[model samples]
Target chain A: MEPKRSKEASGGSGRPRGRVFAFPPSPQRGVALYLQVADQLRGRIDSGELAPGDQLPPEVELADGFGVSRHTVRQALRHLRDRGYLASRQGKGSTVRDRKRGLQVNPVIGSINDLVQFASETVLKPVSVVEEPAGAEVAELLDLEPERSRVVRINGLRCERDGAVFGYTKVYVPVELAKGLRAETIHSVPIYAQVERNSGIEVAGVEQRISAGGADEELVEHLGLEPHEPVLKISRLYYATGGAPVEFAESFHPPSAFEYVIHLRKGF
Target chain B: MEPKRSKEASGGSGRPRGRVFAFPPSPQRGVALYLQVADQLRGRIDSGELAPGDQLPPEVELADGFGVSRHTVRQALRHLRDRGYLASRQGKGSTVRDRKRGLQVNPVIGSINDLVQFASETVLKPVSVVEEPAGAEVAELLDLEPERSRVVRINGLRCERDGAVFGYTKVYVPVELAKGLRAETIHSVPIYAQVERNSGIEVAGVEQRISAGGADEELVEHLGLEPHEPVLKISRLYYATGGAPVEFAESFHPPSAFEYVIHLRKGF
Candidate 1:
């Protein structure tokens, strides 16, 4: 539907495309008309259609383009400015804030096939593979004993197709399972698949825990994230044929780099 | 097995219990002995047993306690400090860094029953419920037209027992289905359930999109999160039996407050 013009909005073509969304004016419901205008403009800024430091059109122009009164446009601009989407000073029209657009990686995590698909889509860069004493928590998760079991810790970065990092990964296996393991295999294949191939024991189950927290300084540097930026922390335990956890893996995902999706049927 | 301790360690009864994790000092393996000590100590600090601002035992005392050389104790201290887990200076003993223990809520999200379970476990406190003009994205998600539809927006917070805030929730329903939706009913019942009950339509499927990003200033204030704290963003669309969209809800979960877990058995 064409936006009814305020008679002057049709005169301007200099504004960057998509910056001025022109749908017919929304019917004034109980909520103020200015709030809708603010939200739509904020959506553009949020999606990066209006980049950092990009100046919003003059109030009269925005007022005309939205087919709203100049007073309403002033109110909308003030709302966005208060929300930090725009920076305004005397005589200088609002400029979009330098807020970074969020980044995310969409990974499916339902079954083993999904694991294989995820592995094929991304490459693992092994940072280190060495034997470390597993503490009580790690021992319990991987089904090892703290006193007798020293686990092989395989740490790495999972990278996207263009070499952008997807996340930092830490995988652990009992020392017995690591004796003949090659770092190359860990980098080239999904670790659980390799475990099943090596031990000839089918993986019976996968338990996943997904949580959120901030990146430490070292992790922030490695993931190229802002310091103290929050991250998605996902850890999985792979069970062998009889409920023995053969592998434990944890990944720290920078939001700009990874996300997960789940679809469920109500009848299921 | 008792920790093999040097004779000097036997004299120390003043150290706080659980602070000195006395697992039989791990068998010296490929990694450095000092590194293993660092890891174990780091684990304690990470789990908050050695709380923020807690002081580490003196070097000679720690050396005897772990049955290690004073030099090794110093090295471990230096490692912990380098990793920002310890605060060390010229003369004082090392102290655990003031790191806030990471927080999370564990939610199961693979079925509609899980939603029922989730709602039953938490309480929602409504902030506002009003008809707002649906933007294009909201319109598409809720199956409405921007020009003709104003969605009933219900905004609230899900709270845990003892009144801790769980997250911020925003739910939208098409105005047609929203007629006579009581704010009291919205607060007490899950909106999707209310839709199913009122519309006489079965919720055929639920599609969920999970992503991550830092909270805005207003959200930070509402959720009691530190400035720029990252959050788990979960949005779900509820579809009717014939695939008509009926409800769209999104929640911003603070990691310290909530987490998601999924269990997938193999051979499905």
Candidate 2:
């Protein structure tokens, strides 16, 4: 439905080579017209029909083509310019510029159990598992006595659809509890769930410490990341129903591959 | 309380010239000995007694000084090494290293109202305020008709306790509602809260989109950020009880100054 124009916008070749947008002016809708036009233009740019440095058709042609007034056409162009999508010179009209690509990864940030839930969408591959003396660090993190304590360390990689490992995880569980956790099932079940199944302890809470750090050599190779690239480092501690610390784990995620998103409710 | 040591852990020199830690070997407690020792060492480093590049007393001397076994001392040192606060050389022994400071700003990730809540702890310095015709982009974001809509734009900086601006925010509100918002009150009250106070609309929901972006010149100047530093960009849309969009705000936060944290419960 095209808005009837008083006079077809003058002085223009209406053709824009490829499929141009059909923005019929609806004066009643007033507010969304220019944005709709801009969205269409953005689409064209994204689709490569409007190449970088390609000058847009004159204002009259755009107005005539979209069946909107010249004023709306100007507004659309200005919006695009503000968004870094277009460059306008005095005599050159408007030229498309290299567009900024938005973020690629948007991970849902949630509970430790969310990892197991994500297993439904992604795949986990076990790298190694070993039983070692629970040293001072592990003992402190997991609430185990250092000198006599033992821990089972499970190393794994969480991979996406394309077989790219997005994160490298190291999970440490008490040796007493680890005996019941099968290595083969590590990929299919969440670590916390496994801990619950084996130890008969319900996970009461999880404490997560998140920070950004430069990737070390090991992560650079395991995640195929560039050396010193920024990575999201997460350390998680799991506590039992009675507040006994049960497990400690650390994971490194490349920024390009994952983003943690959280939703907040007011006054919760 | 220091644990009585067995034979004072036989070793060479007891005098290292500074106050060393008092470690009691609690075999009964089992798990946290090494961590306790590590914490003391960390404290000494932080206290400036163990200067960077200063050799930690030999492990034997440390064991004797702390009245702990050599194994426990080694465990503590290893823990410090992993945290980037200390480095161990094959023949030279452990030396203090520059520690990587964790993120300084950890903001509770919550609703748009949280921004107003934050004002209680800090201060907002207004930069600019103007009433302009709502362009297509702003209209679409705020769910207003472009031709008839006008928006009140407020640009400001959110500064921390040390008089450093950590974020830059731009808030847009429809002119009809913006009429009740006073520029003077914008610093103390969130725009949405003000809109609710004046327009009698209780906000029911908020949609937030967050991503990371490289700082542009504007952010660099306002946030005193280094060129190409990462910034967290958040776009929030506040909706009234009936889902009528009421406010559109965008904020940029320097990575150093703020980290958004959200706690998620299981099965939420």
Candidate 3:
């Protein structure tokens, strides 16, 4: 959208200047003005008209361009930043941050390992492997008929560019799936692929839940964040062919570090 | 743990005693002293001995009780607040805020209809709904085969107790999902169940992605917050029994008003 040049500067007289915003006409009623502004900017970003790392017009320029107050522009920027679309530095102006181009998956897909690989290019950092009793939530997800499922828990960090830990994941695979794979395998290969290679079972579906939280001290230390930093929490369930639960995993991500994208199309 | 009291009160000489602290034996060497104090307090809270809404002892008193400096107690309190266990009110002292209970599921489920019940519970106020083309991301989630998915977008404010507009949500459901429901249904029933009732297809599973953000003006107005308020953003997907994608949703919540929780257990 073209920034609105000052009417006084353009015409110099009382007569109106004939110019329409290249963007859609601002809605007249219902939604608040700043939100309408935010919506417009969000649409532009999603369409790639505003690319990542591109600096936004100054607040004054945006306000003038949109025929709104500087406060309104700031409001829109604040919303975008919180949603991971933009970042602002103290001296530098606000720059577009990538909010798209991350993971997209059907929750009920093959294995947690498959989902992770499909979600992003993965770099794994092994933490530990241990055995423990299935918790209430884990048992429910695995469909274990009392005392039937035992899991080998693998804790690790998944990273993208520069080894920045986008997610800290803990995967619990039934003991049967862990056969032949020692703790050393966790560092060498993706667990889901290993399970398939050894057991000859393909994963087909998955389930997942996502929520928000603040990092505790341990998480902050691992994520290299200051205290009180917010993070994303996700839990996923993976199933093999015919719907047998095979893996359950939970992961956390620093808010500014990642984006989860989904493509919705018109259909039944 | 009992407070380690000094056995002799400096012999009651009335002169200033040497600055020697009487503290319990330290557990592990090399651990930060303040961290140890913080852990003890955290344990009390986790164990339910320090219940939510209970006021913490004054920093001076706590420091004296632990035989440490007031700065140490402040550091611990700050850590607890950062973890969401306690919140400080100026002049009123710090009170436990039940971090676990504060976490909740983001209400933007699959369909706009599903949102109605959540709106009522979370006190959602509608802003508007508009028909729009499916963006690339939204298109993929609905399984639209290349430029196929058309969607109806709904926007609104979600409030918490005390009339604060805690967050904003934008829901996009396939146009078909909007067929049987009117805008009024949003105030009366959840849209997900409504979709199931109309289509005879039960919603079997859901997927969600959550992250933290800051509030914009419209979000602030709706959430009754100031500019730059931190919030949570969530994206969700809904599915049917045959593994068909049904709905896609995104919602946001302020940090002061909402928290997300998951019950986790060890699997064996």
The residue ranges of model 2 lying beyond 4 angstroms of the native Cα positions read A1-116, A127-140, A144-155, A161-168, A174-177, A209-235, A251-257, A265-268, B1-119, B130-140, B144-151, B161-165, B231-233, B254-256, B265-268
What are the clashing pairs of model 2?
A31-B145, A31-B146, A144-B31, A145-B30, A145-B31, A146-B31, B3-B24
User: Ten residues in a row with the worst lDDT in model 3 chain B?
Assistant: B10-19
DockQ of 2: 0.05
Worst 10 residues of 3 chain A by lDDT: A10-19
Stretches of candidate 3 above 4 Å error? Answer: A1-101, A105-120, A145-149, A182-188, B1-124, B127-210, B213-232, B235-250, B253-268
| lDDT by residue (tens digit), candidate 1, B1-268 | 4644343332221222223544354434555667766877887886677987688888887777666667767878877653446756446667776432222111112445556666865777888888889989999887788858899888888786447787998888988887657777766677778777787878877777777778887677788777778888888888887888989998888866776656555522
Query: Tens digit of lDDT per residue, candidate 3, span A129-201?
Result: 8776676677787876445557778888777535657778888877777787666656546676677677887
Q: Each model's TM-score, in the order given? A: 0.58, 0.51, 0.41
Candidate that scores best on lDDT: 1
Q: DockQ of each model against the real complex?
A: 0.24, 0.05, 0.05
Q: Which parts of model 1 have CA positions greater than 4 angstroms off?
A: A1-107, B1-109
- Per-residue lDDT of A63-142 in model 2, one digit per residue for the tens? 87776668778878876764456777877688886543211111464444455567566766788899989988888667
lDDT of each: 0.70, 0.68, 0.62
